[model samples]
Target: MSKARDFILDIFMPTRCPCCEGFIKWDKLLCEECERALEPVDNSNEVPPAGCSAAVSAFKYDGAAKQGIYALKDGWGISFAVYTAPLLAEKLKGCGADLITCVPMAKRKANERGYNQAEVIAKELSKLMGIPYDGGLLTRRTTSMAQHDLETASERAEFAKTLYGIADGHSDITGKKLLLADDIHTTGATLSECAGRLLSMGASDIIAVTLCRTVKEK
Candidate 1:
C-alpha cells in the first residue's frame, strides 16, 4: 500500500528545484545559475551553539540557499530535501550518532504547515547515513513568534527553552549520542534549547546539522 501511494504521488507531483523551478531537470537540485550563486559553508569557520557538541551546515544561508530554503519551508518545495540532505549528511559522517532526530515543531504548527521541513530533511539524512530516525522522541510548544521574528538573542533563547521536552516514557538515552536536524541555523537558540532538555534527561552528546547557516549580521 505504501509503495502504491508513493508511486501515485510521484506521478502526480514532480520534483522541482526550489531556487529555480523552471530551469532544472527532475534529478537536479538547482540550475547552473543558482548553483554557482551558492557559497558553501566552511567547517573551520562554523561555530556550534552553547550546548551543542558540534554543528554544521551544508551551505551558507544566502542567495540560492536563501531562496531554496524559503521555497521548501513555505512553498511546498519539499523535494529540496533530496538535493540538500546528501550534502548535509557528508558533514555528519564522522560524528558517531546513536540515532537521528529533528528539531521538532509544535503539533498545531506542523499541522498547519502540512509538514515540518526539518523533519523532512532529517528523514532524508537518516536514510543516507543508515541511521535510525525517531521522530516521536520529542515534542514542542508553538511560539507566538519565530526566531527570525525576535531581535535580541535573549528573546530567542527564552522562546526556545521550555518549548521542547523529552517525550514521556521515552527518556532512556543515557550515554547515547544524538544528532539533531533542523532546516536552518541562525542564532542557534532553538537547537541549543533542545539540546539542553535532552542532556538534562541523560543524553551524552548532541550534534546539530542544518541545511544552511545564516551569515552573522554586522
Candidate 2:
C-alpha cells in the first residue's frame, strides 16, 4: 500500500526545484553547488550559556535560496520541504535527539495556509533523522507586526516581546536533547525568543536547524 501511494505521487507530482521550478534529479535534492553555497550561522566561539547548538544553512539567502524560500512560502510549492529536509539532515549529522519540534505559526496563519511550512520541514526531518516529531511544544500567538519594516532595534525588541510559548502536556523533555526546526532565520529574533521560552520550560538542551539563514550585509 505504501509503495502504491508513492508510485501514485510520483506520477502525479514530479519533484522540482522550488526556486527554478525545474526538475530535481531523482536521488539528488539540490544540485551540488547549491548544497555547498549554504552559510552556517556563527555559533563557534559565541556559544549560548544554554547547551543549545545550531547548524548553518546550506545556502546564504541570496539568489537560489531566496527564490526557494519565496516559492515555498508564497508559491504554494509545499513539496519543497521534502527536497530540503535531506540537506538539513546532512548538516545535522552526528546530532541525535529524542524529539523534533518545528517553529510554529500564529494560529490564524496556520489555519489560513492549511499548514505550517516549518511543521512540514520538521515532519520530513523526523523521517530522515529517525526522530519523533512534535508540533505542540511551542505555539505562536496572533501575528505581530512585520519585523523587517521596523527601523530600530528597539522596535525589533518590542516585536520580540510578542512571541510566547504554550506547552501541551505531552512527553517530558527535561534533560533530553531537542532539535528545533524552522524554515528560515532572519535577525533570529523569532528563534531567540522561542529558545528563551523553551529554556524557561526546563528543556535541557536545544539544537536549532533551519533551511536558510538571512545574511546581513556588512
Candidate 3:
C-alpha cells in the first residue's frame, strides 16, 4: 500500500479516542478527559535503568497513560506517534543527548504489525529534538518473554541477554551520548539490554526515555 493513499484514507476515517471511543482529530489520540487524567513522571531527577546512566518517562503507566500506550502500540495506526512525540520531546529539554534510537521489534513481528510504535515515536521525537533517529542501531534477534508474563523480575533479568543484537556500521557510537526511546518501560529489562549492547559498542552514555512506565506495586 502506498503511504500517500494510506494517508488520504486515514484522513477520511474518523479517529476515535482510545478510551471513550468518541470522535477525535486525526492527530489526537486521546480525548480531553483521557489526556488530562495522565500524570507525568517526576523525571526531574535522572532515574537510570540498571545498566544505563539515566532514564525518564513521560507518564506513569497507570489508568489513562497505560490505555494510551496500548492504543498506540496495538489499537491505532501509525498516527498515534504524531500525538505521543510531543509528550516525550517536551520532557527531554536539557538532556545532553548526541543521538536517538529505539528498541527494535523482531522483523516478523514488525512486518505483521506494519509499523513499530517505538521507532515511530523516536523518529517523531528526533524531528522535534533535531537529533538523528536511527531505526537500525539494534535488532531483535529473539522474541523473549513479555515482562508482564513473567512471575518475577529476576526471570526477566535472566532472559534479557539473548533478546537483542547490535547492528554494524554503528561503531561511531564510541564516546557519544545516546538517547534510547521506547513506548513503555515495565521491568526495564528491554531497555537495559539495549543500553548495555550500545555501551559495549563504545557508546559513552545512554539516556533511556519512555513515553510510559509501569509503577511497581507494593
Tens-digit per-residue lDDT, 25-105, candidate 2:
544455656555545444343323223566445456777777778877864656556667787788777776778887778
Worst 10 residues of 2 by lDDT: 42-51
Ranking by TM-score: 1, 3, 2
lDDT of all predictions: 0.81, 0.69, 0.77
Per-candidate clash tally: 0, 3, 0
Give a tens-digit lDDT track for model 3, residues 43-117. 765457777777778778888777677777673745445666787788778788888989988877777677788
Give the C-alpha miss distance for residue 147 in model 3, angstroms: 3.8
Output the better candidate (2/3) by TM-score. 3
lDDT winner, 2 or 3: 3
Model 3 TM-score, all chains together: 0.87
**What order do candidates take by lDDT, descending?**
1, 3, 2
TM-score-best of 1 and 2: 1
